[model samples]
Target: MKRYLQYGFTTFADHYGSSEILYGQFRKGLLASAMPTTPRPIGATKWCVFRSPPTPYSRKYVEEAVRERMSRTLSDGIDILQFHWQDYDDPRYMDVIQHLLDIKRDGKLRIDELGLVNFDSRRVDEICRTFGSGALVTNQVQFSLVDTRPLYGMASVCAKHQIKLVTYGTLCGGFLADKWLNKPQPDPYFDSLTPSQRKYLDVILGAWGGWELFQTLLSVLRAIGDRHNGLSISNVAVRWVLDHQFVAAVIVGARLGVAEHKDDNAHVFGLRLSQQDRVDVASVLADRTDKI
Candidate 1:
């Protein structure tokens, strides 16, 4: 499932690389032609496909990407293919499902080889019923120590249906790490980063109770890190999400050639956040509202 979904990103990247996809064309035009065009989302910006500067990814591109990925997976001796959609109603979605079923009947694709992503908890049963039992594999969503709303309903639904979860934004873009512990409030326009990056960082600070409160939260995590054999704050953040049941994996972003942090990221599985560490984190995070 992850492989198919991850491949989708590269598919979009390839399209963008060639300026064939709608958003890719739009972005290329915006950059090269210097025309004042309306911004479109290239893909899922939040958790799935984050397009810098934002652009619309049309249905045609998604369908093409899925087809190519599915074909590649079948050729690789992998029977399962996890299909993901930001919305449930795209015509290509039905077409893809029907195509897969047709192929499965003809011994091309297997029935147990399909899955979905981004559906709400309320729709899980419907998904399972429509797709068949064990067909819908995952409901990837934004779940983290800072955001517990998924636990209220989605987690239970997943548990009931025996579906797995692939969580993103667990570290909230490295904001949970010690880098922001006592750092001053970020200048919205001072940094050269993307608008989306600045926006999420601000939200993380605000939700963690601003800079002062964030310092306190960092101290607690640091203490926990010491007890866990000197695990870093990032290790604790990732572990906190992974420690929860139903989380099959936590998607952590990797900046290529940044060898300094790779060793630290690897330590997440080595140390566990103690019960007291969780309590302290909750205490700091209590009553703080989300900024997303």
Candidate 2:
């Protein structure tokens, strides 16, 4: 997987146990807003970064932050720099984004693309209108079959602005995969689930229907996988997201040096869903997206 292909090397939004992975909840103040960006590990393949800068927003601060991130990349410059900002009430995030875009325009550090991380539909629209079209390239957000919030309204905003969605959680932290199919819901109070699992379980119960509905969804995905040359549920899920025209890419999470699904992940491109496949998945997803 390392030796070939056009895919960019991606990383997790946060270390699995960290609360920052709860990207959508910052508006409610559910998690810390501005933790230090996770350092890119030595020898890591880095294409994009997820960073949230705390205010007082200034050009010096933004430049220094962008420089620090670029210095960590293996090349002289980074391919994609994705910005995350909490405190939507502040309104100075526009200044910060402007500064980053200025740096990219300067071309000294070679920031090939600029994007937003976890900004919602309304914010995306506002930013795009403020910056005018084509100023930024993408927005990274959580979009899995189990959590269709992005599809609810995010997709339309991206289409209108000509921005692509670089999505994470397409696997729902791996719950949407086959290993969890037919499995009973784990008790969060017990050790049956990791912190990430516990986090996504909240999404599963809230944004999706409850456990039984999730199981039914999983069964549908498994059957869909079978229809496409016995592809795994993971492949089926990735395929579903890629099938969306507004989705520029899907960011699958993995722990570096521990495990990687490069081979299985690549198979997603080989499978294509039929019209019936979409209906079956949609049947289980019926009315669940209303909460999102």
Q: Please name the candidate that would achieve the greatest TM-score relative to the true structure.
A: 2
Candidate 1: where are CA atoms >4 Å away?
1-65, 70-80, 88-113, 194-196, 205-208, 290-292
* RMSD in Å for all candidates: 11.0, 9.1
lDDT of 1: 0.58
Candidate 2 overall lDDT versus native: 0.72
Question: Which run of 10 residues does model 2 get worst, by summed lDDT?
Answer: 38-47
- The TM-score between candidate 1 and the true structure equals 0.68
Clashes of each: 6, 0
Best by lDDT: 2
What would the per-residue lDDT of candidate 1 be over residues 48-73, giving only the tens digit for each residue? 23232133445454445445543432
Deviation (Å) of 77 in candidate 2: 1.3
